[model samples]
Target: MERRGTRAAVRTATGTVRRPERTATDEDWPAACREAVLGGAGLLAALTALDGAAGSLDPLRGGLWAALAVTLFALLLPPRVTAGQGWLSARGPLRRRTVRTDRLVSVRWSEGIAQRLVLRDDTGRRLVLDPRVLLANPALWHLFATGARTAQASGALLCGATALRQLTERAEERTARTLLAGSGRA
Candidate 1:
C-alpha cells in the first residue's frame, strides 16, 4: 500500500525489491543529426551555386546564406530524449525538461504540425517530446513503460491510459512489421 506524499516499497514473496536504475537514450539521434546537417549543407550549396551563376555572389550574401543554413539546421534538429527507471527527459537546444514517470499525473498527445507526447507528474514537473523517439528506440520505451506501469499500479496515474494504449499498439505493430520484413514476408 502507498500513502499520499510518500514513496511506497515494492515487496515480493521473499522480501522487498527495488527496480534498478538504468538509462536508455534514443539510438537514432546521431543519424537524425547527420540528416539535419546534410540538409543544411545542401541548402547552402544550392543557394551559393545559384547566386554565383547569376553573378550576385558576394561575401556578405554568402555569409547571410550560411547563417540561414545554420538556423535551418537548428530548427530541424530534434530534441534528445532519454529515460531511466522512474524518469524521462528531453533536451532541446534551448532547455531540458524532465518528468517522473513513476509519479505521473497525466499523459496526453498534443496534435499539431508535429505531434508531441506531454507528460506531467505529481510534482508539477512536465516533459514534452516527439513520440517517434520512443518508436525508434525500444530500450527507451521499455524504461518509460516500466515507470508508467508502476505509477498506474500505485494509482498515481490519473489520466492518459488511452493515449498510452494507443502508443503501445503502435509499438507492437511496428515490431511485428519489422519481424515480418526481416523474414522477407512483409
Candidate 2:
C-alpha cells in the first residue's frame, strides 16, 4: 500500500487510497492574463471621456474619478484558475478562493451570465468557481474527476455526477477528434 506521510489511507467502494486531500499537490495560479487589456483600456478611455480630464475637475472629484477608473480597469482584468493534484484555486486581484478538489463531496452546476461550479468538501468549506476553469485545465479537471468518482463510488456524492459524466464524455470526444484529425498524413 502507498503511504502519504502520517495520514492513513481511506477505503472507498473501489479500493483503499491515500488521503487525496493531503496527497494531491496544490494547483492554482494568480495573474493569469485573459487578454482583457484592450477592453479595459477602452473602458478607461470611455470613463475618462465621460468624466472629463482629472485636471479639469475639482480636486476631490478628480481623485474620485481616477479611483473609479482604476477600479473599473482592474475589474476587467482576467482571473487565474489553477488545479493541482488535490486542490483547485482561483485567484483574482481582489480575492483568492480554493477548494480541496480531492475531498469534494458535492458539486452543483449553476448557469448564469457565467457558469458556476459550486463545490462543497468534507470540511464544510464551499467554493464557487468558473466551470471554464475545469474545461481549460485538464490537470485540474482530472483531480476533480477522480475525487468525484471516488465520492460517487462511495455514495457520498449528493448530486452532479451525471453532469460530470457528460463533461467527461465531451472531453473524451474532443480528445478522440483531435487525435484522429492529426493522425493522417499531411
For residues 36-140, what per-residue lDDT tens digits would candidate 2 score against the true structure? 555555665676666675445465765675676567657766556655566666667788877776667778877669888788877887778777666655555
Please, what are the lDDT tens digits per residue for candidate 1 over residues 87-180?
9998987899999999999999866688899999999998888888887788888888889989989999899999988888888888889899
Q: lDDT values of the candidates?
A: 0.87, 0.64
Q: Stretches of candidate 2 above 4 Å error?
A: 1-34, 49-61, 111-113, 181-186
- Against the true structure, candidate 1 reaches a TM-score of 0.80
Clashing pairs in 2: 27-84, 28-82
